[model samples]
Target: MKRVDVAYVLLFDEQHEKVLMVKNKGANSSYYTLPGGAVEAGETLEEAAIREVKEETGVDIEIGGLSTVSEAFFEERGHHALFFTFTGKIVGGKIEILFPDEIEEIKWMEIDEAETYMYIPEKLNGYVKTNISIPYILRGNVIDKG
Candidate 1:
């Protein structure tokens, strides 16, 4: 399987009450996930996170430390994807669907509520709720059974 690198930024509001998420278009249209995308060649994870968030949600963010690292295998596509999720804060820009073709919607939802919509990483809710003093590393074969 070919390895793919992806970067995701988890951004919470000032009160840290709600998290920023985007409803993707196409196949997983109903699922809501963090504002992020694939890391292009020569771009750092932090840079990819910032660029993806701006392109998908029209929100600019400054990434903090690494939050979690996850791996998912797409059985059908023969892809091994590495997900690097980082803690981030909104630095500027407004909440809007910059690429309506790729992003269905953008919203800030409570952590608990958002977890229900984010089904990929089963332990994501706990990670986000905890005090991220140390980086969380999760290792498993997350097969894309869907």
Candidate 2:
């Protein structure tokens, strides 16, 4: 099984009321999640974050501080992945779904609304504004399967 370090770019609107999201295409087409992808070989975490967002959303972004993280060993998928989620700033481009085969729709969603549609809603359930913890990191390996 291959091991991969995945990165996600979390971009909020100017008002910070909404978050950028993508309803993905392909296998998990119905799943709504943040826009980002795998961290390729030799790519820095920040570079992966920026590249993923652009490739998925066609929007150039300036990555910010690490927002959250989680690690997963997917027995079903036959791989283990470490995930990094980072805050991002929109530097250019529009909300264009770059890869139609992989991305179905793009939208800026309300925080509450986003949580409801997230692939892992519990990741934010007990989160507080002051305390920042890696999303879903405490969940067990086999039992806490997404």
Candidate 3:
């Protein structure tokens, strides 16, 4: 299987009431996800997270800590992905969709709404509402086996 690594950043407003999210324009449909993307070759997870956030949302972030680690296998596609989520604080820059081709819109969504619209809700439950000290882990397949 081909292994892919992705990093995401969770940036909350000063009040910690809203999160920064991006709506990605996929081939078949559009979906909301945190501001992040795949890790580039030779780049560390933290570096990738910061770079992706800037590219996708024009926001600069300082990673605070790892929030969650999720892995999924796509049997049919012969792919495995390791997703790292990190909590970050916005250090500079403003919100903007830097890549219009890949991202449609960027918004500061409410915590409750973000939970509902996130691509992987379960992976976010642990840290979305309550900040956990340890990274929440999720391991499974993209498709059901049963």
lDDT of 1 by residue, 58-95 (tens): 87777776766788899888989998878877778888
Instruction: Give the deviation of candidate 1 from the true structure as CA RMSD.
Output: 7.4
Best model number under lDDT:
3
Candidate 1, superposed: residue stretches over 4 Å from native: 119-125, 131-146
lDDT of 2 by residue, 41-144 (tens): 88877778888899888899876566667788989889899888776679898888778888889998877777565444575663422223333321342211
Tell me which of candidates 1 and 2 scores higher on lDDT: 1
C-alpha lDDT of candidate 3 relative to the true structure: 0.79
Q: Residue 93 in model 2: shift from native, Å?
A: 1.0
Quality of model 1 by C-alpha lDDT = 0.76
Task: Return the clash pairs for model 1, or none.
Answer: none
> Candidate 3, after superposition: displacement of residue 125 in Å?
4.4
User: lDDT scores for all predictions?
Assistant: 0.76, 0.73, 0.79
Give the runs in model 2 whose Cα sits over 4 Å from its true position: 116-146
